[model samples]
Target: MRKIIFLLFLIPILGISQIELKGVLTTGNSGTDVWEYIDPNNGKIYAVVGGNGMSMVDVTDPANPVEVSHLTSVPGFDVKVWQNYVYCVTGGGGTAQIVDISDPANPVIAGSWPSSHNIHIDSNGYLYASSPGTTIYDLNPNPTSPTYLTDIGTEGHDVTIRGNRMIDAHGFAGTYIYDITDPSSPQFLTIITDPDITYHHQGDFSTDGNYLYICDELGNHPQADITVWDITDYGNPTKVDETADPSATPHNLYVIGDYAFTSYYTAGFRVFDISDPSTLVLADEYDTSSATGEGFAGAFGVYPSPTTGNIYINDGSGLYIFGFDGLLG
Candidate 1:
């Protein structure tokens, strides 16, 4: 009888141990807009300031996330990190701020450039800024002093480079692909546009590099959907499949091993199994509904903890971290 009781206790304990939740940091009464969050090479936590400026947090212990320090720049939208530096893009100011975060606790502004909202860093240490268009900067020899290369903003919003191609999520314009083999002169290759789409918000290439998951901020009807495209042929992209739930208004998406985590506006965080890209299916969903409205209360950004299996979600109120158990299985 005692053995049976011991087994029961062990089972529950093991199950709970399989999953764990950690609350990293919380932003207080500042009413500041926390837009983009990135985990730098030094294993520190950094986030872009939207409403006010930029802030840094130490999430070494995700459970007790504490704000280390912050630098006030004109309000910015997104942040990208390469090596020991943090690159932030201002929304309306039209410039990118370079901060040396070699020390996570105290970040110092290294330099600035005429850029906007989103910034991308390539493997070669080149920084690409997206705003009025796509601008490339050479941040190789010295990060603090980046030499402006050229701006390729014929059309696009957020720009990212994979292998030899530069992809742009051109808002209502659609997705554009360019060849950046010659960094100095980027040759426009092709433009992939979906007639039924409105806004192409954010996306990333799959681990396999064969497909691209594009998030349409504007839902099909009044809400957006997750549109998957086959970029096997970078020059001529093809649409594979699209999934639209009644509560689909995906703002940003991140692709993990076999799952795609979507940060939807009012729907919160929705998870889908993309093991089969053509037939992507919904696996599970967590709703962070707001008391303000149906789709307003949930999550703004979802960051899957690198060290821990838990997932951190940022909403209008604060940050919520949850362990992956039934959700992952």
Candidate 2:
């Protein structure tokens, strides 16, 4: 384990916060999305850092994360973990790399894909690679060498799976839903669109799966922050509510239980109490960047670990680990 300089209590740049900065690691490269993986053999948690390339950090100790290994074979703009494997992409034309991380201390590239923009692995161990559009691959038998399954030709930016549902965020096309009960053949459900939608970047479902929350990546667009929809009727999604911080650009969103966590480009990491979708409340916020005005120059990604109870976020500076003590029951 390398010597990790812990920046224990750095104050937030903006409002009072219920979040505490535990530790951080400067990856040297501007960071993007991050994925967590718990080593089954040892039960140690690791954070796969994405950016120009990808690196593995032992976050089992949140106060002192140690960079264990890394791979520069591909530009990792997005990353996801399934079992003992990692799927990553450049969000461009660069080939996607499949890494075997059975040993967190020594990860190795096991295989490759033609290209990918984003990657997601469902509970069934199926890999959904968004290469502008969407392509499904089976990670069964061997996670590294994925077997081609099917393709949803609807061009999109990202894809997410929860239970039997799949949500594909398609910029101006809005968000599309599909029945992924059969991972190989996704049956199109319906497309959720609203006149105010600028860019459907990414989103997550509420705990009950009756509501959907989406984030629009356009910073300057009016009301493009976060939008909520009543997804109880898959064929007819109704826009229920919305919330935004006009000064920042919203990126990705992830939901766990009653809270929705988001990464704002210049605003930093924000947590929303989604118990009432119609009236989402800002539970806690911590500005991770000093740069003012939004143009994608701040927190790039955020991941609230359900297992470790630690929040991981990446900014232009590097990775910041935090613990959120505030939550509205």
Candidate 3:
């Protein structure tokens, strides 16, 4: 049950020297979901932020992003980019929006779904959305028209699909796993809970799918900021490790290669070396907020570009970009 904890909200000391800030594209007072889209026609990458509406940023020049387009819609809480379309999910009795990104500069709303929130698109082109229950959508061949597949009874704070299994990080209710092979008819498998966990908000599987990184979004005193589970067996997940800073509240997390990136609401951005999940180490961090008690006024989500390895972070204030030379291995 060992963990790493600290309290610093402004330019916290760098744990390593490899992390760097390349550029930033600032947006007005907005929060939640930072996703990236790469234009296939011109090879230019676009950074998409969801809030108040959808803002398309040309991160082609990481240091100087041009806001080519802004499509006003419901304030979005989550955004996903697949193929030539950008999918945005609005929480709080919101809808899902599908925008065609074939032309990054002129994105048009392709389609939308009613009653959707916090949607996750899997590798097989299946969209998993959460509300009181989980709703599945199949987006293939054409991104605009997503066919509703099935719905699961159990509700989740966040959901992700890997292969035929669905991982649901259900706060208070713990983490639940489901068999999603049937897409339209999912069956509950198991639920894993830890005594020290407060709120299980979201989770990300390791590259090999052997471990699950769970984020705990505690408002006041934190029990654990992140609880790692050995999910080798989906039926029975064992608590392997945990990490958190003093007075920490984690928001979103994404894993890439040997590293896992997280955005702590007040603690700013954190990078962890997950080569060894049993003894996860804090790799690096960048602080963007001044408040420290974790009341949701800092980094909201971290999106690392698959094409360029640059990190895109969205906070309540603005959007930022960070870069790394290479792994510390």
Q: TM-score for all predictions?
A: 0.79, 0.90, 0.88
Residue-pair clashes, model 3: 2
Which 10 consecutive residues of model 3 have the lowest summed lDDT?
1-10
Tens digit of lDDT per residue, candidate 2, span 1-329?
12332222333433334677888887544379887888877888888888877788888888888888777775688888888777888787868888888887778888888677787888888888875788899888777788998897667788878899998988778888899888888898888887787788898888888898888887365675888888888767888788867688888888877788888888888888877765578887888888777578899878888777778887888888888754322
Error of 2 at 195 (Å): 2.1
Error of 2 at 70 (Å): 2.7
Backbone clashes for every candidate come to 9, 0, 2
Q: Write the per-residue lDDT of candidate 1 for residues 1-329, one digit (tens) a residue.
A: 99999987897677532334456344631222343344545545544333345666555565776666666753435666667776766654566677876776677888877767666788898887766677788988788788888887655677768788777888878877788998779898777788777777667777677888887776555443777888888667888788775744666676666677666767766777777765567766666545333233456666554444557566665555556554455
Spell out the clash pairs found in candidate 3: 5-245, 6-246
The residue-by-residue lDDT of candidate 3 on 7-122, one tens digit each, is 23222464443578888766542478888887778888878887777888888888887788887864567888888888887775656778887887788888877656588888
Lowest lDDT block of 10, candidate 1:
28-37
Q: Any idea how many clashes model 2 has?
A: 0
Estimate every model's Cα lDDT from 0 to 1: 0.65, 0.80, 0.77
Task: Report the lDDT of model 3 for residue 136.
Answer: 83
lDDT winner, 1 or 2: 2
